[model samples]
Each structure stands twice: as C-alpha cells, then as structure tokens.
Target chain A: MNVAVIGLGLIGGSLLQALEAAGHAVTGYDADPATRELAEKDGRNVAGSVAEAAAGAEIVALAVPLPVLPGVIAELAGYDGLITDVTSVKGPVRALGIRRFVGGHPMAGKETSGYAAADPALFDGCAWVLCLEPGETDLDDWLTAAALFTALGARVVPATAAEHDRAVAEISHVPHLLAAALARRLVGNPLAAALGAGSFRDGTRVAGTRAELIAAMCGGNATATREVLTAVIDDLRQRLDELSAADPVEALIPALREAGDARRAWPPKPGAAAEEPAGAEELLALGRAGGWVTAVSESRVTVRTMRPESDRITP
Target chain B: MNVAVIGLGLIGGSLLQALEAAGHAVTGYDADPATRELAEKDGRNVAGSVAEAAAGAEIVALAVPLPVLPGVIAELAGYDGLITDVTSVKGPVRALGIRRFVGGHPMAGKETSGYAAADPALFDGCAWVLCLEPGETDLDDWLTAAALFTALGARVVPATAAEHDRAVAEISHVPHLLAAALARRLVGNPLAAALGAGSFRDGTRVAGTRAELIAAMCGGNATATREVLTAVIDDLRQRLDELSAADPVEALIPALREAGDARRAWPPKPGAAAEEPAGAEELLALGRAGGWVTAVSESRVTVRTMRPESDRITP
Candidate 1:
C-alpha cells in the first residue's frame, strides 16, 4: 500500500511512521518547512508539498488542523485516491462531499502536540473511527482505510458522520467544556483551588488542554455539543432542585447509585469472540453497541461485541 | 500529647497511625467490632469503646462517618478535652454545639477505605483544615490541634465551619456531583462509552467512588454544593447558548482561555517565608488566601501563602 499523510503534526507524523513501520510505502508532508526538514533529517520520506505527497499514493490522509482542513481538501480535488482525515470533528468534513473520502477520527491523543512528539504507537489499541457515510462513502475505500488502521493495532469503529459527531460530543467535546467550566469556577477562589484534591484535579484535567484546540473541537461540533451540554445542564439543574427538597440526600441517592453503577460498568468486558457483521448497517449497529471491527475483508466484517455484566457495580 | 481517635475507618485509622508515628500516645476505637479487632491485631492501641478511648486523653478526634458523628459526639458530652472532627462537612458538625469542639477536615483520602487501607503517611504534605469559630473557639485548643497536625507534616489551614463547607463544596462535593452526572450520561450510550478517553475517564474518576459516600458529602454540604453546582450549570448554559450563535467558536474562546488560565494557574506556588499571622482573624484570612500553617506556638503562627505567578497559563 502507498500512503501519503499531509500536515505532519503529531497524528500525521505518527500515522506516517506507523504506516511505514507496517510495511506501507509512506510519504509525509507538513506546511512548516522546519517540520519537513526535521522529518527529512529523521530519514522519513518527506514530501515538499501536498501535491508531492499525494502523487502516486493510493491513500491520502489529511492530518491538518480543522481550520486548514477545507483548504487541504480543496487541494486534493483532482486526486483519484482514497481520502481520509484525522480531525476530531467529522460532520463538517463529511459535508464537503468529497468522493472516495471516509471521514476519520482516532480516539487517541497526548497532552503534547507537533511532529516532535509523534509516536508510531500512538493509535495502538485505540478506536479509529471511520465515517461510513450512507450512500456516499465507497465501501472499498472505507475497508482499505479500516485495514490500514487495523494493521496499526487500532480497533476500527464504523459510524456515520452524524453518529461520530454526536458520540464525540457526548464523550469528548462536552467533557472539555464541562472541565473548562469547572476549572473556571476556581478563579478568585484560591481556597477552593488549594483544597482541590483528586476529584477536582481529574474533573478539570482537560481544562489544562490548549484553549484553541479545545475551542476548535467543541465549536466545530456545535450542534451536537450544545445538545449534550444542555442535557447535562438539565440533569444538574434537576439535581439542584432535589437539593432543595425536604431530604436532599435521600433524593440524590438513586441518581448517584445509577451513575455509580454506570461508571463502574464501563469499558464492558469483551464478548466471546469476533462475530461477522451482516452488512454496513450491522457494522454501524455493532459500533453503536460498543463493538469494534477487528478485521475487514471483501466478503465479511469481524467485530467483537462488549458484554456488560449485570452485577458489575453491585457490592 | 495524648490523642484519642474515634472510628477506625481509613481516615481515622490513618490519623491514629500518623499521630502515633509522630510519637503521640494515640488510642483508636471503632463502632464495628471487626474493625476494632483488625486494628488491635495490627498492633494499634484499639479501645473497645468510645468512652474507653476518650478517658485520660487530652485531645479527642472524632473520625467517624457523618451519620455516626452525632452519636459519637453525644457520647463525649461532658468531656473537658480539646475536641476535633475529621468530617468532610463542617457546618452540621459545628451545629452540633459540642463544647471544646473545633471542626476540622483534612483534604486527603484514598479511593479505598477501612482500617486495612490506612497509611501512616496519608496526611503527609496534605492540607489539614482547623476551623476557628470567631467567638466560640478557644485559642489554646485551636493552636494545640494545629501544632499536632503540623507535627504530622500536614499544613494546617485555619478556616471557619462555613468557609470550609463552601470551599469543599466548590472543590470537592460539586465536582463529585458533576462527575456522577457525566458518568450517568453514558448509561445507554455505549458508543460514547467506547469513545471515552482521558477526559471522560478523568472527569468521571470520582463517579467510581462509593455512591453512598458521594451522596453524603454532596448532601451534607447541600446548600454550598447546590450554589456551586448551579453556577456551573449556568456557565455551561451560557456556553451552550454560545454554540447556537453565528460565531460559536469565536464566542467560546475567551471563556475557554479564562478557564485554561485558571486551571493552569492552579495550585499557585508557595509564597515567601512563613509570615507571622497577626491573630485569629489574620490566621483565618491566611487560610482563605490559600496559606497554611507551618508551625503554631503560644506567641506566633507561621504560614506559607501561595503566590500565584502571572503569565502562568498564557502561552
């Protein structure tokens, strides 16, 4: 397989390294001259420009930041190869209507960024989401992309752009906003800041992320993020109302128990073995059911379903 | 100094060990016979009853759960010793009107509880809050408790019952509720659960805590927790509204930056040398300013104030 990864930042550089290490012929390109120079100096196949990278490549992965994505996508207009992206948000990219493009977002990252911090093992054992846009995405191209990520030891999750966006909004984008909001409350409250222990530290950890990056991710998925955030606000408001009740503690116990049960039951144990997905709908259904694709072929798709235990959170 | 620690749970047991390790004659007691046997078997001086532990002790520390606190306090009714508590919520305990009682809450804990998980060094470098009720607290007794915790390598922060409750609500109780709410959202959304990474994991870490414990902490500090949680909900609501705006990304940046600044500025660095607190009023002021007592004596109280450096979260 011939691969081209553009915008040689952490994800791009890592993909280039991982794909190359997986015996794929890889070429990488970055907008910054110094990054290209560094990759070239590191014995990587460094392309001078987007055209140079995409030329003669069977697959092109645009790993540029969200703001630069439209321009990069525009530059790949005439290219006939399979296209994918590593952006956190997928809805907007999917709306671009690019042929042979399967929007992707790997659920993996580090606190640090840039080519210097790239590691080939970054996506290992991580969920690499491939947006299987109904009626749009080419099955062959999607499978090729899934196979590439699977080869790098990633679990490929088949989802539509809308599903991907909503899921991430619930899991990633809204969590960032909530963290920021929680951290913001600490302002002018030095005592509270001082008293912050494990809960505050962990809850607000993502608030320490780069502001611009968080803004891009959350803001880009505005609709889904807003919906989820509103729901959270409503849930909290209900809890607040309960706090005013005659017996607030008693009123909160059931909700807390439910949450505790859900939390403790997370990352559900893997089921017996990989089962063949009937079709694309089944593949997407499996993903929504907390299952991941282990292998994809011309004839069948294999996935491991998560089995949630009933008595997991109970004492 | 002779100390009697009532309750042999994690905090109580750890306090017993830490105090004994600091060369204090510490005797421990618990309501559970099994816990008493375990403590006695572990070579700790375990008292069969609260009265036995309280007898011949100059300082009595109530390290019991919130529900058992009133009964424990009732048992110590006419004892003329310096009484202190390690309950998370101080307002209710302060309202108990126990003479010679000083409300205290140590901002340190482990995920696991019980006597078996006790560690002598648990309070090392942790903030041990000592409530100084403006008109009710005895200066000598307050100083004695402060000195004891200071000797255990804990930073003693002088706070009022209300102040401690509010601070913990902002930093601890409310965060617990938020984590629970976040975790609760994943109840049926397995895809979101599958996509959950560091942010979700960290944000929901405390949700995995004992539900009853969380309920007690949040509920015991109901008023303060509700206020803080309401504020958080409002902030999130405003962010949600911003997401509906034309330039949601631009609208959200300033707030995110502020939060990022606050989060990064956390835990402001320790200020200059330990300055002498003027009086009880000054000591309370230092605690509110995020300063902790390094030493306490008949003449002076030495504290190290946190110095938040400028340009911390800024690039």
Candidate 2:
C-alpha cells in the first residue's frame, strides 16, 4: 500500500515512520523546504510538492497545523484517494466537504512538536477517533483506515464529527484552557512558583503547550467549546457559592465526595507506568474500603480488616 | 531536643519519623486513640493526652486539621515553649497571639493520607515555609526552629503569615478548587473519561484528595482564597469572552503566549525525576535557546539553526 502524508511535522513525520514500519510505502510533503529536507534526512521519501505526494497514492493523510489545514485540504481536492486528518478538532473540517474524507484525531501528543520530536511509538496503544458519515464514506473505506490505525497500535473508535467535537471539548480542549488559566494566574508570583510542588506542577503541566495550536483548536470549535465552558463555569460558581454558606464545610462534603469518587473511578491512562504488580487477585488483599485499596505492599502478607468508608477519602 | 507532635496523621507521623531520624527525642499525641496506637505501633513514644505531650517538651508542633487548631493552641497555652503548626493556612493562626509561635507549612503531600503513607523522607528537598513576626517570636526561637527544619533536609523559606497565606491561595488551595471543578464536569461523561489523556489526568489529580482536609484548609483561609479565586475567574472570563470575538484565534495569542512562557520558566519541582543527566554543562553543547536546551541526544550531535519564534510553537 502506498501512503502519502502531507505537512511533515510531528504527527506527519511520526505517521510516515509508523506507516513505513507497518509495511506501507510512505511519501511525505511539506510547504516548508526545511521540513521536507528533514523528512528526507530521516530516510523517508520526500515529495517536491503536495500534488507529487498525492499522485498514485492509495491513502493521503493531512497532518498539518489547524490554521493552515483548509488551504492544504483545498490543494488536495484534486486527489482521488482515501483522505483523513490528524487534527485535534473535527467539526469545521467535516464541513469542508472534501470527497472520501474521513476525520481522525490521534488522542496522543507530546509537549513538544516538529519532526525532531516525532516518535514512531507516539500512537502506540492510544485512542484514535474516526469521524464517519455513512452516506459520504463507505464501510470499506472506513474499515481500511481503521485497520491501518490498528496496525500502528491504535484503538479506533468510530463516531460522528459532532460527537467527536463535543467529547474533545470536554476532555482535551477545556483542560488545556484550565491549565493555561492557572499558569496565567502564576505569572508574577515567584514565591508561589518556587513553592509549587507535585500537585501544582501536574495541574499546570499542559500550560507549557503551544499557544497558536491551542488558539487554533479552541477557535475552530468555538460553539462546542463555549457550551462546555459555560456549563463548567456554572458548576464552579455553584461550588464557590457553597463556600459562603452557613456551614461551608458541611456544604462542601457532598461535592468533594462526588468529585473524588468520579476522579478515582476514571480509568487509568493506557501504558501508564505500573506502580504495582498487574496480577491483583493473586496478591494478598490488605484491605479495601470506599473503592480504595487501604494497604498493599510487595512483601507484606498480613491482611487487616477494611477501614470504614468515612476513613478512605481517596483511592 | 525534646519535641511534641500533637497529631499522628500523614504530616504528623512523617514529621515524627523525620525528626526522630534527625536525632530529636519526639513525643506524639492524637485526638483519636487509634491514631496514637498507630504511632505507638510504629515504635514512637505516645503521650496519653495533649497536656502530657506538651509537658516538658521544648517545642510543641501542632499537626492537627485546621478546624481544631485553635483549641489545640489553647490547650498548650501554659506550656511556655516554642509553638509551631503544619496547617496549610497561617494567617488566622498567626492572629491567635500565642507567645513564641512560628508558623510552618511543608510544600509536600500525597493524595492518600494517614500514618500508613508516612515516610521519614517525605519532606526531603521540599520547600518548607516558616512564618515569624519580629516582635512576637524572638530571633533566637525562630533560628532554633529553622535549624531543626534545615536538619530534616528542607529548604526553609521565611515569610509573614499573610504572605504565606496569599501564596498558598494561588498555588495550592486554588489549584485544588480548579481540579475539583474539572472533575465535577467529568462526572456524567463516560466518553470523555475514556478519552481523557495525560493533560486531563494531571489537571484533575488533586480532585481525589480528601474532602474534609480541603474544606478545613479552604475554610480556614477563606479571605485569601476568595481573593485569588476572584482574580482567576476574572482572567478566565476575559479569555472566554474572546471566543466570540471577530478574530478569535488572533485574540487568543497574547493569553496563550503569556501562559506558555510563564509555565516554561516556572522552576521544575524540587527532587523531581531527573529527565536528562545532572551534568549537562560538561557535555558538549548542541544548542541553546530561550533558557531551554534546544537539542541534545545520545545518538548523534547535529546542530541546526533555531527556527523563528512564530514557527517555534511548542518547545
């Protein structure tokens, strides 16, 4: 199979490497001559122009930045092949009205960007969203893309473009905004920055992400993002109001408990570092309460009674 | 030196262990008998009552929750020794007018609490804030407390109680509120949880922290916390309003760039995982840009000209 990837940056460069490793002949092109040179230096075929890359290719993937995506898509309108994108947002792209277009978003990214930071293993065990319209794209075409994504160690989930946009707004886009907001709050406070520990660092880590990329993403899906943000702000306002109640501490109990439980139950990230052994049933159960493992160690064999639910605050 | 720790939970238990390891004879007391038993089981000296722990102890450290701190201070009024606390907030505590009192807060904690999670190395290389008033606590007493904190492998930062509270509001307390708010948004959304990646997980990790503990900390410092929250919400509201602007993406540039720059320069957490080797200066420099090491790899040394600022989005 021949695959042509346009815009040889992080996602494009990485897709070139991974697709080639998966036994596909991959070609790449970028508007920037330096980026094309970088791809050639990485031992991948580099096309002189977008038309050259799209010629005689079975699949063409658009991996460009969101701001320049429309121009790239317009250039690729003459290509007669399966088309997909790796953009974080999908609603506006779906309205682009390109033939054989199937929207995709690899739910994976690093804090860094460009071909230099590209890794073939970037998409390994990651969730990849596939936006499909039945009347526009046949099942065979969608299946082909899904199979290729799976070959690159991705778990493909099929959804409509609107569904994908809403989900990304709640999970990815708004989280970035929150991180950036928190970092903005810390701008002039050196003492706070010096005192920021694991929690603060973890909470604001995403704030270091690219500014334009975030702007393009949030701007492209303004309606969905705004809707989610409105709901989130309303929830937060309710929480803030409770802080001024007669029994503020008592009022906080339910909200805190619910949030804690929801956060605790959220599935752990795939390929996350395993802090404990994977085999849980065989290991001695020290104790459990309120869905939290009270105590379990590698060498300890004593199994104590479970603590009360009130005592187990977090998992 | 004789030290009394009047709480045996995570912070108190760890303080006792670290202090004992630093060659101080320590006595511990807890309001709950179970906590005192846990301390005794760990082979630490346990006192029968708060008065018993305070009797003849040269230093009394109150490590109880914020709500009960005043009562604990009142109980120790007759001890006539240097008094300190481990509460997250310090302004209200400083107003208690206790003689020879110096406020301290260690910038180190875990989501999971209790004596079981306590480790003697918990505070190693952590920022420990010490609050001292010129006329209230003599320099000699403050120096004594500072020396002990230094002995336990802490970088002691001396500040006024009000300064400490304001900083904590921005860095620690408000971050918790944001995390809780994000987690609350995720409560009913299963697809979002399944698709949530590193950013969402890290941003909301603190949402799983104990409820009562957060309530106590926030309620204890309501004035400072509310002040910081108001500013943060204002910043967020301004950003949100820009989503509807004529050129939304262009408008997002300033806020995003400011956040990215601030987050980039924020000091890495003390004792964080060493990403690169500690001795980077000795190694041949590949390149440097904007206070960041542009490129360094073990494979080969290839130096390239830095890209323009507009093109260099993510670091």
Candidate 3:
C-alpha cells in the first residue's frame, strides 16, 4: 500500500519508517522545512507540500499534533483519499472541518520524539482506535488507513468523535494534567522529594509536560477535558473527604487495597509500572482482593486478601 | 547474611526468593500459622513467630500493609535488629514506630501481589527509599538493610517519614486516588469506557484499585492525602474559574502555557513533558515546568481549561 503521512515529526516519521519497512510506499510532508529535510535525509519519500504528499496515496496519516489537525485537514479536503490521524484525541478531528478522513489513533509510544525516536514496533500489539463520522464510511482512504493500522499489528476499534474525546479526556488528558499538577508541589520540597521513591516517579512520570502541545490539546478539547477532569477530581475528593470523615482513619488501608486492585485490573502486561519489573506482587494484590487465586510462580503460589477487609499471607 | 522476612505474602514471599537468590539465609515468618506453614513448604526457612524471624537475623523486612506496621514495630521492640518495611507510605510508619528501623520503600511494584508474582528482579534498578529517624546513624541493622537495597540496584536515599509520605502521596498514592476516583465515574459508564482509548486507560489505570487498601490508605492518611488532593482540586478549580470567568478570557492559553511549564519544570528529567510514551499526540501540558510531553500515539491529545479557547497550532 502507498501512504502519505503529514507532520513528519515523531509520529509521522515513525509511521513513515514503519510503513516503508512493512513493504509500503510512503511519502512524508511537514510544514517545517527542517523537519521535511530530516525526513528526506532519513530515506523516506518527502513531499514539497501537503497536496503533493496526498496526490495519489491510498492512506494519508496526519501525524500532525492534535492542535494543528484542523487546518491541515482543511488543506487536504480537495484530495480524494482515505485519511486518518495519529492524534490522541479523535472527537475534534471529525467535528472540525476535516474531510475524507477516518480517525485513527494507535496506542503505542515512547517518551522521546522526533524522527530519531520512532520505533518500528511502536504500534505493534497495541489498540488502534478508529473513530468514524456518520457519513464517513464511503471514503476509500478511511478503509486504507484502517488496513494500514491492522498491518502495523493494532486492533482497530471504531468509535464516534465525541466518544473518543471523552474517553481520552477521562484517561490520558486527566492523568497527564494531574501528574503535571502534582509534580508542581515537588518544586520547593527537597527532603520529601529528594528521597523520592519509585511511586513518586511512576505517579508523576508525566509531570513535566510540553507547554505548547498540551496547551493546544487543552485549548481544542477543553470541554471534554474539563468534564473528565471534573469527574476525576470529584471522585478523588469524595474519597478523601470520606477518609477525613472517618475516625482513626483506618480507611487508608482499604483504600490502598481497592486502589491497588483497580490499578492491577488494567495493565496485564509486563513493564507497566515506572521502575518495577513484572511482579509477583500484582497477583498478591489480586489475592488480597478475595479468593481470586492466582499462581505467582509455577510452583510457589501465595494467596492474599482472604476477604476484602484483611490480608493474610496464604502459606 | 541471615534474613528474616515477616508477613509471608507477596512482599514477604518475594523477599524470601530474592534473599535466597542473593545468598542470604532467609527465615520467613507470619502471624498466621497457615502462612508460616506455606512458607515452610515454599522452600524458605519459615520462622515460627515474628520474634523468631527477627531474633539473631542480620536484617528483618516487614512486608506487611501500612496500617499494621506499628503493631509489627511494637512486636519488634525487644529485638535488636535492623528493620525495614515494604509499605508504600512512610510518614505514619516513622511517627508511630521506634528507631533501629530505617524506613525503606522500594519504588518497585505491580498491580498484582503474592508468592506467584515474586521475583528477585522486582527491585532491580528501582529506588529503595530510606527515611532516617532522629538518630539513624546508631542502628547496626540500618546498614544491613541499606546494603541489601544497594545490592538490589536500588538507589538509597535517606529521608524523614513526613517527607516520604508527602512524596508518595504526591507521586504514588495521590496518583492512585486520581486513577481510582476517575475510574469510578466510568464504572457506570462502561459502554463509553469500552469505547475508550489509551488516554482513558493511562488516566484511570489505578482506578481499578483494591477497595480495602484504598479505604485504609485514605482513612489512615487522610490528613496528608486530603491535603494533597485538596491542593489538586483547588488548583483545578481555580484554573476553571479563571477559564470561565467571563466573556474575555484572554489569558487562557497563557495560563495553560504557565500550567504546562509548571508541569515541565517538575520532575526535571531530560525531557519532562516528552516522556509520556503513549497517547494521541505530543501532550505538552505546561510550557517546560510540567515535563508532561507524553506522546499519545493514538486518538487525540485532549486538553481542558474552563475557558472556551482553542490552541492555534503554529503553521
């Protein structure tokens, strides 16, 4: 398949490389001449302009930042091609004046960006989210984009634009904001943070955020982000209030157990935590949940959390 | 060196295997006779009681829940041993307990726990935090625990319990509260959540928490946890209020930029905001302060403020 990728920075560069490596013809386009030059030097096909990139491409991957997608999409409206974006939030992409585009966001990443950090296996075994507008099915580029995602080993999930926005707001955006905000307090405190452990690192791993990109995302998706953050803050505040209301505050343990259970429920893969390896304690948290018997090792299994109230080490 | 592991559950069992692997004579102990029996069968030297575990042992690791640490400390009052705990929080542990114990928490973990998940490498390259009491230098066992942690590839830093607590609250526990509380809103909205993307997962990952544990942590550490949560909520509320203040919210993007910068300035890693490996776009929350540059490879990188402003991606 032939692909035209917009934005040529980290996501675009990686997508171009991945597509080309997978035996697909790929062309890259970016507004920044430097970025374009870098992509060209990297040996991927480079386009002089947006139109040239999408001229005859089967799939168009808009690797532009979310804030820039609308204008970029408007530029591509004249082209008749299957279009998708590697943007995080999907709602605005469709709601905005984008044309001939099916929203696709691949759940894969690394902290570092630019063409240098693009990993070929970035999207492998991850969820590739596809959001479609009501009348977007007939677009051939949408189908091609979905195929490209599948070829990259991502499970394509179809959703509406609003659904995508709200979902991301709830999960990705809110966490990033909280981490950033939380890390703010660490500014002055030395002793507290100097002895900072892994939990702090893992929790605030996303603390120092990029100003421009986040500002753009927040500015564009403020409504959804606000709603999601509001709900999250409320939930957390309520729990905290409940703890404050409790006598002797014995509720903290149960809270940890529940929090641990919840955290464990989500990531079933290895290398999920910031610094910890795949742990036997994850099963211990589950065992602490109830009679949920899980094998820690092939032979040395230990059960925990007999009932929800207490944790007994099962010999 | 001989090691005695108290509370033969996840941390305990893991300690047993880890200590054995590290060439330590490990004697495992648990209050539960059954757990002790299980430890005996699991191929570790199972001690009959907490005293037996601590008696003549070079190092004693209290791998129990936070709320129970005081009782464990009380039980250890007579024994002259170097003590450490694997509990996530340290403030209460130090305040409620005696000396001869170096408060060490390995910033290592998983969502799961128990003997099955136990591995020696769980502590590899992780931060094993050590909090010094008023007179930490006098304890002989302190050096033993520190050596054990150092051997595990963990960077040992001395800190106060309050410092450790606040740090963990900011980084680990607080994040858990955020994740769980955020997840709660989605519990009833599974359909919407089912359509959710990577951001949703990343944000609420800790939301699938252990109910009892969360309850306990919040209940017991309400003062510290509430303080942190309140700060977070208050900060957000203020931002929202400023955002939706009136018709002229001119300072919206600037405010977001400041917030993003705050996020970037925190945690001060090589690339703060850029470190987020998964999501829609490059989420630059705060300018440079937040260090929140998590590249969401899928969907949209949604950002929110109370105002109705949109970011203009630089052309």
**Against the true structure, what is every candidate's RMSD?**
3.6, 13.6, 16.1
Q: What is each candidate's DockQ, to 2 decimals?
A: 0.73, 0.26, 0.16
Best-performing candidate as measured by lDDT: 1
lDDT of 2 by residue, A155-262 (tens): 665666776788788877788888888888667565676577766788888888889878888878787888887777777676677777777667767888788887
Provide the TM-score for each candidate, comma-separated: 0.91, 0.77, 0.60
**Residue A5, model 2: Cα distance from true site in angstroms:** 2.6
DockQ of the two-chain complex in candidate 1 = 0.73
- Candidate 3 residue-wise lDDT, B1-315, digit = tens: 878888877667776887788888888887778777666776778877788778888778899887577788778877886777887777667766566677777777776876666777776655566665544434334445555766665544445566566656666666667666655544434324433445455556555555665556555566777778888888776555543544212434454455455444443332211223221122112211222111222222232211001122234
Sorted by TM-score (best first), the order is 1, 2, 3
lDDT at B67 for candidate 3?
59
lDDT of 2 by residue, B238-315 (tens): 778988899878888799899999888776333211123312231111111111122223322321122214223354
Better of 1 and 2 by DockQ: 1
For residues A1-315, write the lDDT of model 3, one tens digit per residue: 778988877677778888888899888898998888887787778999898998888778888876587678777866876777877777656667555667777767777888777777777756566665555544234335555666676544455667667766666666666665666665544334434444455555554556455555554567787787776666666666676664634544554455455445443222211111112333223322322221122222222111222223345
* Candidate 2 chain B weakest ten by summed lDDT: B282-291
Task: Go through the candidates in order and give each one's C-alpha lDDT.
Answer: 0.84, 0.74, 0.60
Location of the lowest summed lDDT over 10 successive residues in candidate 1 chain A: A304-313
